[model samples]
Target: MWTGNFWKQAAERAVKTFAQASLALLTGDGMGVLDVNWGDVASVGALAAIASLLTSIVTSTVGEPNDPSAVRRTNP
Candidate 1:
């Protein structure tokens, strides 16, 4: 169930996450950022799955609304 606003929000979150990841990569020392255990790996995997799902939904329903009334427009 993807709507315009949901797509926008998911895109925003993805962009922010990428930015933060880029900064972390640049600022962290050699081993500090590279360090990852099982829990961290699982968490990242879950996040990736969720992001993938959101992206798929957004792509599949580019213009449709999950709920039209929830979205505000100026042309109405």
Candidate 2:
């Protein structure tokens, strides 16, 4: 997790999670896009981002040392 690549992957995951969470909230049951509670969306997004970061940390040791999303270490 100390490598720059790992951090970049973590950041990307967090941003994607935040965007998805915001969209889910905006489209929730009986709610129009304009009816979104911005504060709630932000809170959920932040929590999702933090979870993504923690997942990245926990999985980092199992993959490529420098790449958080890698499924296996390369033999280069």
Candidate 3:
């Protein structure tokens, strides 16, 4: 289950990840911006990595706040 905070964190992480990875092209390609090749598989992989990080963060965060898992854990 996902809390509102989880989505919020994921959104922020994805944006930051995209920006950082895209900026990396500037240094590597001397393009001063995201290079065209960045639109390739590596970019998609980076996005997936970002999503994974979000999921992990949210999973670890579970059972902390009002942790939506509380109800399920008690019932099961």
> How do these models rank on lDDT, best leading?
2, 3, 1
TM-score of each: 0.40, 0.84, 0.49
Residue-level lDDT of model 2, residues 10-60, one tens digit each, is 999999999998778877646876776789999999999999888889988
Clashing pairs in 2: none
Q: Is candidate 1 or candidate 2 better by TM-score?
A: 2
Give the range of the ten consecutive residues with the poorest summed lDDT in model 1: 63-72
Q: Runs in model 2 with CA error above 4 Å? A: 73-76
Per residue, candidate 1 scores C-alpha lDDT tens digits across 1-76 of 5457665655555665655554554455344545745355455545654665466465544434542122344575
- List lDDT for all candidates, in order: 0.52, 0.84, 0.56
The candidate maximizing TM-score is 2
Candidate 3 collision pairs: none
Candidate 1's displacement at residue 30, Å, is 7.3
Highest lDDT among the candidates is held by which one? 2
Q: Tell me how far the alpha carbon of residue 5 in candidate 3 is from the true structure, in angstroms, after superposition.
A: 1.1
Greater lDDT among 1 and 2 belongs to 2
Model 3 Cα lDDT, one tens digit per residue, 1-76: 3577755655666666666665665455665333356555367648765765656565644655533222235554
